[model samples]
Target: MKPMQSPLQHTQGGTSSGHRAWSALIGPIGLAMAVGVAYFLGARLSLALLTKPDGVAVFWPAAGIASGTLIALGPRARLPVVLGVVAATIVANILGDRNFAAGVVFALCNAGEALLVAGLIQRTFGREFRLESLRSVVG
Candidate 1:
């Protein structure tokens, strides 16, 4: 006689146990919002200094780093948060002054901030996406 198989065995595994929507959108959206707020605040604070050509040197990078680091700290959201920070920083720079030089500065600062924040999280909170090691046992 042939062995019986369950109907579910033929399917592509069971339904996902993790979040479907938050994993898709909330994290990235939150990061974008935070970056926007930071950028505007930075721009406003630097307005007086930005009156001179050299004063454009001050705000954008600081804003990008601060916002990016904060966003990366959310749970189960490392990937989206980091990407959103970069995207928002670039968008903010482009829309604020529409210049390549300023855009590059924002990019570098955002990248640095993401790296630093990710490293700290990995070291302190323990990595959530690591493979588990198998243990040996005697019967």
Candidate 2:
């Protein structure tokens, strides 16, 4: 004496093992893509802005991108995001012809800066924070 379930209902609410497996695979793949693209763009821009022999860029967009990614992905994905950033950093340095040791140090600094920025922004503005507001600009 039970009612039958609709296909839509089953697809939407059922705990199918297939759905779980897809999500598990897709999430990491998606995250890796996002990180790789962001890191590549940021590193390229930073290299373009390099104005001195010391290898420092006039403006490091990677820092901002890393921070923004961390914010968007929330805290659960920090390690992976940072790892992506570090990999990107090493790649950038190698392409720019810098030494391996220098690349590692620079990557560490960039990741640390991104982590600090993300933590501060999350703590100050909660999860609803946005940079489009004047308040966010001022704060």
Candidate 3:
């Protein structure tokens, strides 16, 4: 008699269960790293591009990075990515002499923007969607 294989054991393309588990664990870590790097780069660029008395940048690079990350990571990675963004935002704000309340608010806005972008992309194109052409742009 043949032995029954568990669902997890039947990994796609013969990948091992241990490998899949490691990848699952690493995905969030990579997201966190990406968020941190994006935040840092945004802060530097914002400081360099400061022209107004309010010190706001003409382009917030972190916003685009966060949105792109959320889109690429998919729905399953939302929580971790949001948490990472919040942490990065708060740290950046505090280091830049901003208050905790402001940091929290800004973090919330950043998170909300990422969620909105990700949800729109997912809803408009489904999970297997790709921004590959003019149709994707139009959509």
**Best prediction by TM-score:** 2
What digit string (tens of lDDT, one per residue) describes model 1 on residues 4-121?
Answer: 4322122233435354343345545665566556644564455435646554545445444553344334344445445555565566566666687776676667656666755664
Better of 1 and 3 by lDDT: 3
User: Residue 13, candidate 2: how far off, in angstroms?
Assistant: 4.4
Give Cα distance to truth, residue 20, candidate 1, Å. Answer: 3.6
Give model 1's TM-score versus the native structure: 0.45
Q: Per-residue lDDT for 1-139 in model 2, tens only?
A: 5465322123344558797566655665567567867886888888978887776688887787888878876776677678778888888888888889988898899889889988998899987778798989777
TM agreement with the true structure for every prediction: 0.45, 0.77, 0.76
When summed lDDT is taken over every stretch of 10 residues in candidate 1, the lowest stretch is: 130-139
Instruction: Please write out the lDDT profile of model 3 over residues 1-139, one tens digit for every residue.
Output: 5464332233355668797787766666776776777766685566467676887767778887778877876776787778878888887787777899998998899889989988998998888778788877787
Q: Which lDDT values do the candidates have, in the order given?
A: 0.51, 0.77, 0.76
What's the lDDT of the predicted structure labeled candidate 1? 0.51
Question: Which of 1 and 2 is ahead in TM-score?
Answer: 2
Deviation from native of the Cα of residue 99 in model 1, angstroms: 2.0
